[model samples]
Target: MPVARLSPATLSAVRVTLPGLGVIAVAVALSLAVNRLVPAVSPLTGAVVLGVLVGNLPVLPESARPGLKWATRRFLRAGVVLLGVQLSVAQVLQLGGGMLLVVLVTVLTTFFGTVLLGRLLGLPRGLTLMVSTGFSICGASAVAAVEGIVEREESEVATAVGLVTLFGSVSMLVLPLLADGVELGMWAGASVHEVAQVVAAASPAGAAAVAAAVVVKLSRVVLLAPLAAGLSIAERRRRPAAEGGRPPLIPLFVLGFLAMVVVRSTELFPEAWVPMTKDVTGLLLAGALFGLGSGVRVRSLAKTGPKALVLGLGSTLLVTLVAYTGVRLLG
Candidate 1:
């Protein structure tokens, strides 16, 4: 009897990719559980930690590497694109002119400032770029988005992820204690690394603070595509003149993200579905981060030196001071 046979190409692709993807799926599930139980670190952040632990502990099977690579590149990009569903043009504009300026200035300053500091500290350009995105934008999501623009070793990516997650989580505890209500909210919205961390930090103040912080942080989130596109352009320009290739003004996935933002602005999606969409987006992002995390070598990242650490601390301080100044000036 004759039996159906899988094509060699298809079979080979699946053999290489499926195992790592399955591992990522499990990591995402674990992340969700941690999110529910712990409620401090974000599921995406948790997933990265989980991946790091698995990766550095000698448990990572070689068979899963191909899928991990696929997830880090493809899944991360797709997740960032889908994240746009949670934002809207109107939502950002409603923060008022002063708050808008604050968000814009904070992101730009933190981004460029970190890169310059990285140069001064002699950190690798690619690692600095990744860390800059994490600090200037929306933490891991921003790191994942910028990953498309700056090609680098996964170890660098992992290092950036670790720094942001550590600082972001710390801020959740420390920021609230520094101020109350609107003051704390403004500070956090403008300064905190991730949306989840912003919420956690600001919620202690009040619901009103949470509302303000979420809006402010989302404004930062809105900056992701533009910043990424700017990097892509700059990178293309910096290439040797002989290369002669002009990159797209925006990545296709970034364009998709912008489209999702527009769709969201129209308010066509049912309000009821927004929460569910956010959950799905978080899951996708978590799975991607887990894959990225599995590539981390803790010892290798350590050898890259304390320069990246200084950069992270400096970036964090820069944003915090800038955000506080904005809060005072704008008020």
Candidate 2:
């Protein structure tokens, strides 16, 4: 008789991770269903919303934590890296020196300006950094990437995610209603929090607008690696040896992101691979967001309500103004 069975340790590991993984899997499925039924809502955003519902209503169980951690850490990083597959250096370069400058100035001003504003408003640096990153760069995905660098609380992550959802949706709807609205796809692509939001905001402008917005948005995305690396360096220095050992100069995941960008730029991958890669990246990110959302404590999030609302509003306004200005002048 020949038999094959799992090792004891392997089975133990599965036992530890499975419950959380199960929950994440189910959340993702439901999120996807919601998105399918409501085409206006992105599955990734739906994942976080559903996760918040699950965590808050039923209360996420302790036993599910290990898998949640695994999902957020591994899946999130992989998704971020794969995001590069959608971009090429040439796409960004097409924006020309002026439009590229608009993208750069907008990102830098929004990020730093939000940080300074948060400090003045007495918000925690972690919350500010995450929120600013979300507003400045790529939304929830950027917040997730920087979470590892700054080691923020899950509640803070939820709050940052909340603001991204709130203002991003507003921008998505409002941007298309403006004068030269569709043309402002460059502005939407520059300022809106999520890529999905940018696409939604710009898509009505036609394929050309969508194309312009995406290229500009992806340029902002390319900033993630450097911003994260710089933050990681500062964070590693700030912590004492007693608190933790020094981390890599740049997080490995960030490096992986850069590598993917290079792969895409070189045209090493077939054009046909683009859609498949985007789908995979979207799924992975949605899963990670669900995991993060499961950790939220709403009451804690409320503690920062007034200040957070103000900060979120301000950040949104700041980015919008900057992006609008940049695009008007340069674009």
Candidate 3:
């Protein structure tokens, strides 16, 4: 067998990449432990929290940043692609045309409405869009999905994630206490920020509620692809032709996402692979969030923080009301 040779550039990349990735791996382990100890504290959210904590610390090595960024890009794409495996076109269809309409309407309304609100607040469009995506769709994963296309500041991504975590946690605690189990389940599933947050909010109501919330939440997750496409087109048109090379109308990872959706729909993979896919996807996404968090500078963001926070509050309230209206009308 021929000896495998490593180029100078490849060696340099490996050297820099491994250190940051290793940092995220340790962070992921701690996040996983925290999730186990407190089931409601999702590993993905924990990963972002831990990353933010470590990132703000004064002594973190420069060598690790490249790997962390690598995780943000590579791992994020992989996670989004695998995210589709958790959904099926069949699951969405089972919701029937009316419930499907609810999902579609909720997404469209929240997305555009948040953009309008952000304009009125004079916040950056990127920050508003990321916030909108997180609230309107699936939370941090959704936040990260549109991040590249929006070309916003890293602080904005962290802000969006923070908003998702805060509002989602609050919704988890408060919704169940309203005393309508099944109805609340559909409503929370449609409106809640994160998947785990939805499940946590609904679990107290029992299994049927949990199932309803999850199906609705995953239905929302299905919209991520088209949302990416629409944003991409908008971004393309907004930019000058000479600004740079144009972004694709539909990103490659989105196509990968769609492909996995097909795989899940056709039962192309054995059911045994599902659990594995979930675990792998979870790890990659958690690590990716950690990477994204590392780029945020808390003090540096102080100026925009308040505006983003207010926008977040408005976006959350808006999505919640719209989703409740849909649930009530369609139920």
TM-score of each: 0.92, 0.94, 0.95
Which 10-residue span in candidate 3 carries the lowest summed lDDT?
A: 300-309
Model 3's TM-score against the true structure: 0.95
Evaluate residue 129 in candidate 1 and report its C-alpha lDDT on the 0 to 100 scale. 96
**lDDT for 133 (candidate 1):** 93
Q: Whole-model lDDT, candidate 1?
A: 0.87
**Model 3, 305: alpha-carbon shift in Å?**
2.3
User: How far out, in Å, is residue 134 in model 1?
Assistant: 0.9
Better of 2 and 3 by lDDT: 3
Residue-wise lDDT of candidate 1 within 201-234, one digit each (tens)? 9998899999999989998999998898898888
Error of 2 at 82 (Å): 1.0
Clashing pairs in 3: none
Question: In candidate 3, how many Å is residue 43 off?
Answer: 1.8
> Against the true structure, whose lDDT is highest?
3
Give the runs in model 1 whose Cα sits over 4 Å from its true position: 1-8, 241-248
Model 2, span 1-49: residue lDDT tens = 9799999999999999999998888888898898889765777778887
The better-scoring model by lDDT among 1 and 3 is 3
Better of 1 and 2 by TM-score: 2
Candidate 3, 215-330: lDDT as tens digits: 99999999999999899999999988899866888899999999999999995778788889999999999999898888888886677877887888888888888988998898
